[model samples]
Target: MHRNLWSGFCLSSLLAVFSTLSGCIDSRGIIPQALRFDDAKLTTDQTIRKADRTVEWPRDQWWQAYGDPQLNAWVELALAGSPDLAMAAARLRQALALAGVAESEHAPQVKLDASVQRKHWPADRYFYGPGVLGDTTGWNNTTALGMNYDLDLWGRLRSDTERALSLAEVAATEERAAALELQNNVVAAYIQLALHHARLDIAEAELKQREQLLELARERLAIGIGTQLEISEAEAPLPEAHRQIDLIEEEIALTRNQLAALAGKGPGEGARLERPKLSLHGEPALPSNLPLELLGRRPDVVARRWQVAAEARGIEVAKADFYPNVNLVAFLGASSTTGDMLNFLTNGSKLTYGIGPTLSLPVFDGGRRRGKLSEATAAYDLAVEQYNQTLVAALKGVSDQLIRLHSLHEQEIFVGHGLETAERRYQLAEEAYRRGLTDYRSVLEAQSQLFDQQFLEQQIHAAHLTAQADLWVELGGGALTDDSGPAAEQLDAHKTTLHLPGRH
Candidate 1:
């Protein structure tokens, strides 16, 4: 009874020493220095505030709003085949697999181990005991089944798993962002093709007009009422008009090739593309939820937010390292160098089995744990700042698109009026020249003015279309919804708020 009491006291004293040693490695001075930015708390810029906010959030297939079936088909094709998206999908899968690895830490691990080898015992008089078969060779064999499980007393495994899952979420959102960007590229390139077609029409018409004026000048000269200079003036513009047609056709071909490449097809496929029929009926208005919903709407922003959450979990994982780890371990095995190899398995005396709990306390690591915690905290701060920057840039992108669209709309109206006036002025000038009331110079001036106005109109129209597509991209292209949360719930569940070293 006295010996039993002594053994128990010694065990208690040993545990006390372990606990005191563990307390020496402090984690009090390390903490994350960055705070996450709240989307709702961020003030909306005047640019977003002043814009018309009547439209709903964009639909998932926002490109279809342009009423172009071909565009929709191309976007779908790109989503299916683009290398960029495929890579993003692969990265997401990899992250999910890593998350699985982390989660497996919570479950018991079982392993089977077996070994067999031929051995020889040398007869050394000083090292060998008196026994039979002292110099004999024999088969040595062993087999064991072992299991281990971590207790996770400090939530380390949970935080690690959560961090991995958050990174997986980040990959998913980045994949979505890549898809949206692909869609935008397809639409923008298609719009350029349409603009080239419009320009071609203008060029062909101008060519025809120049030919007609050249013929009319000849007739006037034949009747002794027009000078040779008039004929030369009309002929001069014909080659330029033809050149313009050639340039626009080249642009159309190049844009078609670009669209085909975006869809992961060859230049020959682009050669078969028809002229794009893209139209936007009205201005794309801002959603009622502006900067607030913008957080979830933009895939890039969502990805950054997920990254921040993952980093927050990383800090937790690092903090957990400062504590002790406990693991339950069990093993059952047999080993023998005598009799048959199977004797160890069958003989009860050769069998061995044991189960116990193992403890690991970090008594000293020369500030390694503190350094890791510091690194994790710094990474967390970087992620938060990146998220903040993404949010700001996203809002700025929306405002910039809105401003361009508004300006393009106003420019389109003025260009349209100018085109009409130039048309009337050219018609009057032509009539005056035919009636011998003015020289060819006045008619040439009016025609040049009309061509300039027409070109400006087409340019403004293309700008308006491109701006609309950009706005759709900025608004998240229907990836966002009203119910999208800030992804704080999961992080909050495992959050261990700690004070910074210098702060309260």
Candidate 2:
């Protein structure tokens, strides 16, 4: 008994030594090199200094701030019906299922196996001994229950589960990003429709003015005070003005179709849409902690950050692969080749059972383990770089939108003043022409100037509205917040160089 006890101790010590030596693959050089971006370090103080920083972040339904009920309804419809969003949602569900699969790996597994057969042995004198039972048929049956449970001494299963969960988070954020994009598209199309309506109004007004000018020219000619040149010039502008009206009306119809498509409906549905009365009370404002908060606000950035986290977990899984894997395996069953069909279960001699621990050590595999580790580390670095790139692009998008909004605001002021002066000049020119104090050319030139300024004013106004929409989109469309899943900073906090068991 003492010798047996010593033999068991020696076996355990040998196993321990073998396990320690099995992890000899050089994993010290396989480490990720890419670094996560620090949101606080990305300076944006001077860029948005003039922006109103007192307003809160945009709400979930940010489009409602435009104060247009029709816009609100359309946005809601798009959210419910958009196929792009549906696809994104499906991807998220698939990711969640995969995560569940990974988690299941950490749990113990049990299986039942059973088989039954009737066998016949031929009575050949040379193949069987004299006393052997031959030329007989018997029932052969077996039934067993087996179980396996991993010890998880290396945390391989845990890291794999974590990676899958992080990928699920990435999918969730992508879904949010898709939803936000749909909303932006719907609003953008509606804004274009509104601008088209405004332009149509201007075109119709110009056509009316041209008709009145032509009538005035005819009256002057009948009173022997105007030349044929005046009538010809007035008629020429009338045709062009009508054509402008037609073009604007066509644009309006096309824009309506675009809005319907964005809502995942037919063109006819969009045709029923009334002119949008979109308006905002004040200029869009930024938050005081724009740069620092943007990491959590932008869905794309959040998704990328989650991807990095998943890859980091992948590195852990790979590192765990270099260690030994231990599993507890057990089975209980009965088998019989004689007696009744149920003899296997009733006879004590047929009983069979086993329970033991199994160990799998990676001795050598032609550098397969090292290759996997290198691959994992490379994947982690790639994800980190992608996250960093996304963050940079997000910041640039915000700054670009803000700059456009500011420029549009300043241009709107100038265009308003120019429009007022043009309207006054056109009125004076018409009055002088009717009194025979100026020629028809002066009236035509003044009308041209007034129309150009009117178009310019409308253009600036439309730009301001579109730029505001873009800013909201660049600001993440309010799809993320404190209540959202893990933030980029939180994910980055877990980022570190992975080391093997004994590597310094």
Candidate 3:
């Protein structure tokens, strides 16, 4: 009896000491409560205006830069039709909802539960006094309410909440990236269709000119002045131009179908785009050595950066599992093991309650927790590497686009001059042949040359339009304006996303 008493006393003292030490650990979790991305400072670029080219972007409507109302309408329809945009919007909401869940965890957990039970005993059972009564068949009734909570002795909860918020920000950034990409696709399709129509028109015009030359050659052959070879040569270019038209038509149809899918309607939904009278202007000058400070403006980069932060917080969560966890459980109830339920509730109803913290120490787990922490840490490192890779890729795209724009513009200029000279040469050749200064063969050669020139011009024109679109995509498209978001916050302290850190 003495040994048992001493052991119990020693245990009580040990508990008292441990309780004082446990005060250092708290269910309040991390200090200051919230981990905010506001602390992440972004570097600014002072050289944004040094780009040497100062041209205004088509602000109200990017498609207007092409000076085509039809293109504007088609692009708008595609933006409205994109199912991917809708999906992206929905996902953003989902992530925000998950963030709300994490935020809720920061508050005290509260719960309520109610239940009832009935029990029966055999008449043979007897206890206490009144042997005859105890031997009677009987039933028992009980009702109860319960509540339970876990005390956050480690920073696990706080880390989890921060991770959730980061994920939400990542979702929002992804949505923006998806929207931008969709817009670029719509515009690209519209421009391509317009370019094909332009080329087809030029091809048909050349084909008509060839038909006129062929008629003249046949007349000469009938008069015995021209050979069958001359007539055949003049007719050759006609089929080539028609063949070009067929290829262009095929491309136009396919592009229209692509636009249709983008608009979220039947494959033929978007407004038909007319080929704009595009003034073959020299290449659009892109901004050079853009401020690295605005690198976060790219949604893809920002999203990736947030992912890195989420992984970092995950590491902390794994580390937390290495510590002890404290849970508090409690209940209140009334019960009576009596034959009469009403009588049992009359002053004899049992009432009870329980409140205490449970400490779950990390003793032996076969290294599972350690493995998880290592995995989380590795994932964080990978995310960082990916962020750097994205940054480099974005810069490379901009650089390459700039070079192509210049080269394409120069090529178009020379091709335009060549087409004009060839047209004049064909007109002179026809006049000379009619007056007998040249033979049917000279007119035939000139006509073919003109046909070649027109076809070359068509290709060069398309190349110009393609290069322009490339520039838009590189500058991240849309009206060139304030490229940075002051209102958009970094979502994670260790990473950055576009919602002002704590606003979402």
Candidate 4:
């Protein structure tokens, strides 16, 4: 009796010590350091200008600014059916479901367990050595209802739920990013298709002109008025023009195939695509002053931010592992001696019930808890660094695109003037050659220079449009301007849909 009293005293002292340690650990909340960045402090080029800040940002459907119904249709198709976007959407749903699972931990869980079985026990069983509870070889039946719930004394469950919610938000943003990517790809492809059409037209016109010049040269040579050298020079550009036609046609066909694939359709669908008539000038006008914080609205940046938040919450969860876990458990059960299991549910049968709390504290674990805490802290730090890098890259992307657009605008002006000058020079050279004031070589050289100038002009025009498309995409396809919660909401609304263009 004295030993039993001493053992009880020792156990009480141990419990008291552990309870004190748990309180101390709980007082030190696991909160990661906060991160912040200034909106106007990022590095920007001198070409950046200030515009009316009051002007509204671009709409989410910014491609509509191009006024091309076909482009709008294609973008809608890609957004709804692109495999990449669908994958991101699926990931987001999975994250949300995981979050729901985490949330369920906050509530009590109850389970009903029922079993019926025949049992054979020796009359000399250890607990009842002489069959004290009646015959030991009869059928045994039991039924129980059990309930268990974590007490969450240290806010661990709350932290876990928050971490899951943050991850779900990250997935939501990624889905938006994927949708934006699909929109950008479709627009760029459509622009390339248009450029191919222009190239083909230019090649055909140049080839026709070359054929006329070749005929004129052959006629002059036959009449002994032109040298064989002149005929050979005229023949030189004709084959190149023909080759350009073939090459451009091949590119157009390939581009259409790419668009069809992007829209999640068969290659034959590409053959039905018409030449795009997109006007690129002054469409989707840019805001005057772009604050650095605006880039934070980008889906990728937002996703990275959520990643940091989730990792920060993870640290709290890991730190909670160092403290005691408390649980409330209860069970109500009945046993039946006969083969009829339903007898256990009757009031007359032997009944048993238990209700109590369980507490567990880690005294030793080979430093596993400390290691987990360290890992969580390190992961949080990594997430912060990654978020910083993503922000920097986003700023650079915006600056680079701004510089490119400005340079293209300047180039277009000069190329336009050069094209006009070359056209006039070619006209003068042709008239001079017809009157025999200049050699046929002069006319051929002038005409070749004119063709080169025209091609350059066409190329410049195409590049300007493509640059605009690039800028549109770099700006997140105007996703930042929308107040929608996430692209996941859009995906959910279209869960049962194959074509979602009309739905939006």
CA error at residue 36 for candidate 4, angstroms: 4.7
Off by over 4 Å in 1: 1-8, 282-284, 287-290, 340-349, 481-504
TM-score-superior candidate, 1 or 4:
1
- By TM-score, how accurate is candidate 4? 0.85
Q: Which 10 consecutive positions of candidate 4 have the poorest summed lDDT?
A: 492-501
**Per-residue C-alpha lDDT of model 2 across residues 1-504, encoded as one tens digit per residue:** 999999999989989887677877657888889888887778774656445342345667888878889999999998888888889999999999999999998898999998887877678788854544577787878999999999899899999999999999999999999988888888888888887887777778778888999999999999999989999988988777888889998998999888888878999988899977877644445555556565566888889989999999999999888888999999999888776777777754377899999988888789998999999999999999998888888888878987887787677778768877988999999999999999999998998898787777767766777777788888888664534422222111111111111110
Model 3 agreement with the true structure over 214-320: per-residue lDDT tens digits: 88788888887878987877877777778888998888878877888877777545335444444322223333334353344567778888998898898888878
| lDDT digits (tens) for residues 232-280 of candidate 1 | 9888887778888999889999998898899888999888888777766
Q: Per-residue lDDT tens digits of candidate 4, residues 165-203? A: 999999999999888778878888887887777767667
Between candidates 1 and 4, which one is better according to lDDT? 1
lDDT of each: 0.80, 0.80, 0.64, 0.74
C-alpha positional error of residue 372 in candidate 4 after TM-score superposition, expressed in Å: 1.5
Q: Which stretches of candidate 4 lie over 4 Å from their true place?
A: 1-15, 20-36, 50-56, 123-128, 132-136, 222-224, 227-229, 281-293, 338-342, 482-504
What lDDT score is found at residue 165 in candidate 2? 99
